[model samples]
Target: MRNHNTLKWMIGGLVCGLVMMACSLSGLAPADTGDSEVDLQKTQLALQATQLSIQADQLAATQTAMAVPAAPAEPAAPPTSAPAEVPTADETKRVNNVNGVYFEYPAWLASDVAASIYDAPPPNADDPYFLIEVDHRVFEFQNYSLADHFLTPLINVYPLEEYQRVNPGAAAQITLLKDLISWQSLGASRPDGLPFLPIFNAAQSFFTKVEFINTDSVNGLRYLTQFQQATYPIQNGQMIYTFQGITTDGKYYISAVFPESHAILEPYDDFEYTAEFEENFLGYLMEIGEQLRAEPDESFNPGLDALDGVIESLRVE
Candidate 1:
């Protein structure tokens, strides 16, 4: 509606300008006419009328623009180009170390991903979370997020390698185990008594399940995967996740986490939604988790084909 009125005004302005220009060219009122004061007054009023009409049209257009109509039922996502592919293992020359941790990614992502690739700050300074976007056509609105699995590139390299030994026969398959972070299964204490306890306890309210998806090796580094179920959108994509990490011992490692969705509905903080949506979404998530936990079968896809190259080519410091 506003667009239509703006166009109308624009067209009218063009006509007015043309009429004024044509009158000036044709000499509609010559200086030597010797017209009376009354004629002059009438001409002045006519000009004033034309000016007023233009002003009115301008005012109407302005008002139409300022007036906010009802918002659309759902907002359209902004257009986005494909995220430049993260470097593959083949591109030896282009492979670049990322952030301060020095993990490696394919040259394509190193060159074409986010504008801040070269200097993008580490995602988590305290417990840094590095995000590597492989696909970009998956644009997000309020927050840029992506698919259910393989949402982002993740690599967790802990200082120790023996950590994964707890899961025997983990090399060829993934075993889903509960992590202590879950408020239900564990308490807020750690043996080392690091500062992580306060942080974990602080974050406990939002986090529900923290699962370990483990494997002993993927090429050179011991593979570690973790899924921390929380109210947050990233984990909300699936009630669980399957991730990739790099570790020598497994005591300390770097892991991947991809951003997922916003709370399903807007103004999402209302309790009315929490009871209904949370239960519904949780039920959905458990169903998916069951399938993922099943004996390693043909269905599991951790995006290894796309990620393994980058991981294998990693040049970690």
Candidate 2:
């Protein structure tokens, strides 16, 4: 009903405008005309046309509004990259106590492996030679057949004076071992056997990754090398990583030898020691040492870092 009234008002306004236009076209004043009914009909038709045009415009406006889409939401920020995690020491450690001395080894080394402790005989029976062994299973060697089963992997502790006292005949060897103040002063000649220990055979070789490591009570040198009596190529199950250190008080000596293998090395020690090889044996050993030194600690089985952790936890008292 309100819309009908609004439409009537609009028709009346159009009719007044048409009347004025007609008077102007006819050159007369806007007064009552003889064709008033005809003018009224023409005004109503014009009003309907104007209303249709308005309705079309409103319909077009509504369709345009529906066609357009809302603006896209802002993109989320890129995720931040996290820093590389630093390796931590294993929480599970086995406290190894032997001959009143104590240290820790990884619990993994003791699991599923034969371990024993014995008083190894020194050159002088009076000297103390405490030894502990962990069987070969502890090391995952590719060529276990080539390993020295008798040696296994062992840690030994000895009284410095008694150890030095036993080999009285070899005064030069004893003096050299005693004078081992630094690895930098190490001569071209490597020790044939374990430092100050008896040797059935000795290997002439160079050291790799040589570093001085001190435990809670001792200070010593740790290095990786193979013990070969002949010109044997560096192979799996033959490389020995050993640590030799003296107590801070200089009263006791400590040594730990662990068998390690590398995937980069030959699976077997099958190199022929020909005359040419003998001539360049030192060069061969140096090249091999360089290759081993270039590799990161993780390259070896049971990792050198893990062994260093064991040495760091030692307490001779």
Best by TM-score: 2
List the global CA lDDT of all models: 0.27, 0.48
Top-lDDT candidate index: 2
Compared with the true structure, model 2 gives a TM-score of 0.55
List per-candidate RMSD values in Å: 30.9, 48.5
lDDT, residue 147, model 1: 36
Clashes of each: 22, 0
TM-score of each: 0.29, 0.55
Look at candidate 1 and tell me the lDDT of residue 197. 6
Candidate 1 lDDT over 235-288, as tens digits, reads 333222223343334333343333223233123233343545454544443343
User: Which ten contiguous residues of candidate 2 have the minimum total lDDT?
Assistant: 35-44
lDDT of 2 by residue, 124-235 (tens): 4543211211111111212222243213465656566665554332223334445554543344433332232222122324457766775558777777765433454666
Q: Which stretches of candidate 1 lie over 4 Å from their true place?
A: 1-246, 249-252, 259-282, 291-304
